[model samples]
Target: MSPSLSIATTVSPASLAGTLVSNSKNVLCSLHWKNNDATKTNRNLKFRVCSVSGGYNTSVENVPFPRDYVELISQAKEAVELAMKDEKQLMEIEFPTSGLASVPGDGEGATEMTGSINMIREFCDRLLAPEKARTTRIFFPEANEVKFAQNTVFGGTYFKLDYLTKPSLFEDFGFFERVKMADRVKPEDELFLVAYPYFNVNEMLVVEELYKEAVVNTERKLIIFNGELDRIRSGYYPKFFYPKLAALTKTLLPKMETVYYIHNFKGQKGGVLFRCYPGPWQVLRRTRNKYICVHQQESMPSLKEVALDILASA
Candidate 1:
């Protein structure tokens, strides 16, 4: 199917996974480095997968098989748990749902989007106990996805599935009405997970509203899962067009902790900006089968600086 899709990533060797860019019927099974030569240094990585329809015959013994997405989700779940344990009420976990080669917020293509949905489901399974699941609310970008999740990833779970926005008839052309959190949030809900709010600009604004109304000055905690808040931080949406979104960089963002993050920069001098809570920010470059930290700092570095300076220099 589709010539067995392959892509590159800057994720660490232990958790390397390429973007699975097919429909829901396809499954990404097994990943192996294309370059087996130990002496030849490889800058870019190639991830190969077998689709479910492809019989899943590919095998890699000794080396981990099919742990790509699992490892990433596991690490992300740990980061979120650490953030909550540290008393962080507002937190973020941003990574490319697609492979590292793809830009975040451009669009979460169907394959990667489903990957994220499944990742969220597995993440919650590992993150919350059965009793805790009943008190947690998970918000999707729109009402339609909530229905999908109810039957798929979150099936049989008492955890609530809600939405941030509702699409109007003109939604296909980038128009959607924001859903108010006042009517959606329950008093029993102790935690909220907002998933992929960057689909529509209004979604994140609604997220800010959720924080102010339900999360603030309370024991409740909020985690933005794959929201792609960097679009606002990097000024991708012009301040003139999205002033409220731009304001979040100064207001809501500073209070939030990025518990886990992975942003890849691709070019002649390619590298990944990686961070996991309680760990320092790191700039990593791929050399053959391994990733070496080129630079690291305590504070988060701007994406622009990471691309132009850190990656360029490293």
Candidate 2:
């Protein structure tokens, strides 16, 4: 299943775009403004970026890679190991699956996902010796394209950021405010470290702060997968901005190795940046051709007083 982030609010899409661009400008302006209000309010996230290797490597070779990147990779690796002895098993791939149609247009997500998938297909060709990697297209997202690589170990990672902290938290930290899981994350809990396209890559201080949070906080091991360096290239990974991010994450989060996971685009086991389209087709699914899916009538909530059966502890 493909998933993505939701950027919605009460404002119309057009207006939201305008507002975000304006806000982005405002945020940029604050970085230079000496005025405390302007400087303090800036959400410039440049400094929190850093340089590291890009793409897949032995270090990231895991099975069924973790859920998403981490989980999926682990699963892939496990699948690889289990199939090592079975040549027929490795060859049981369906090639056309990964070649399915993607959502049209310049959507960053779609392109990125497609690019990643293409790279993955290529990776399978190299690492698995024809027996393992196979691509196929399954109908999902209302009949869009999906690349399914069998036997290709999934060992990469992608991270989800808690952009705005909880409301009513600290005097300075009250944007989207509360951070509920940093403390609970453990070494065994899979982590996807992705350097996203959402942050400002020019600000150094902000990068430093993010770096600290990942590095000093807990005892669990975490991977700050540098999607930035891998996808975008190094012309802008660290120019006072990137390193601060890597550095700060190291400081703030406890017990972690802030190493870079670079992608190899060349050699046999090189890396690639693929993008898949979790296109608008998904939204279009509601209107199937000739067959309209009538969503059943909505059910109203009933607060009935049911018996409270408490099972005794075993």
Candidate 3:
């Protein structure tokens, strides 16, 4: 949101080659350029560009703009404003400290819920970078809940699966079949972003299969973003399933370069991102290998920090 971070600029149809659009939600601009190919006729292209700037510099692809470009831009602006308003409301929502105390953790604490929101935003920005566009694949098991405003920011082919309401599909071979049929993932792809709640419990078997497929199909990095750790610790997670899940992860650890277990800690306001590798049966059986906390702040660590840690660990 700071001017030093980014500045949006409007450029004419003739200046697409040199024009740079800064990464700012406020700035909605368009550009026109002609793709000149001697083999084919010269064709003019219109793109709605949103340039984001951070430690890594990259540009969004030149997407074809609709004829009602003005209306589209206006809608985008309104959506961004609405998202900001919602974020402000989230910051005001207090954490249920009383409920968290019932868990096996220490006392209560307050954390700005805005921290998690910002972290997710930063995560999307980093994953959506043009360089990652080719290798990264994002999966959101619950898609209907996604807001249009957020979808605009994470522009990519997201595999949205409605697995919660239809749990039967995941219990059998349907889940894998769906994944294979829906997305033709290449072996060269390097990163997978999975946004699913309660990842370690009921869905452990399905998740194991999913990870196996990912490792077999493409030796890529998989990061599972879970927001329901509190529920898991509150006796809601199945006790019998944990051991099986741990064993499965341990066996698959050799093939997985780095398995990141990012979740909100119990009895804590902020979230924690850690690198979890399966090894030492005693350690895994006892404490499940001490998770190396890559990012920890007052509330939830920023997504930029998580992205940097992932790169560093790699």
Candidate with the greatest TM-score versus the true structure: 1
* Candidate 2 residue lDDT tens string, 1-314: 22221222232222111111112111100111111221212121111111112231111111100112332233333333333333211111111111222221224654554555444433333334433222111111111121121212232312112221223434344223233334523344322222221223322232233334533453312223222322122233453644554553334222222121212122222211121111000000111111111110112111110001110100
> For residues 1-314, what per-residue lDDT tens digits would candidate 1 score against the true structure?
43343343345463454334333332322233443323212122222322223433222111122124555666677667777889999999877776644565456466666767887887888788889998999999998889888878788889989999998989789999888899999989999999888778999899999999999999999999888788889999999988998999999999999988888777789877877776667677755555555665668999999898888876
For model 1, where is the 10-residue window of minimal lDDT?
58-67
lDDT (CA) per prediction: 0.73, 0.24, 0.34
Cα lDDT for residue 21, candidate 2:
13
| Model 3 C-alpha lDDT per residue in residues 18-67, reported as the tens digit of each score | 23333333222223334432221222333333345554343332322212
Could you arrange the candidates by lDDT from highest to lowest?
1, 3, 2
The local distance difference test score of model 2 is 0.24
Query: What are the candidates' C-alpha RMSDs?
Result: 13.9, 26.4, 18.5
Cα lDDT for residue 42, model 2? 13
TM-score of 3: 0.35
- Model 1 vs. true fold: TM: 0.76
Global lDDT of model 3: 0.34
* lDDT of candidate 3 at residue 114, scale 0 to 100: 25
For residue 26, model 2's alpha carbon misses the true position, in angstroms, by 54
- By lDDT, the best candidate is 1
- Clash count, predicted structure 3: 1
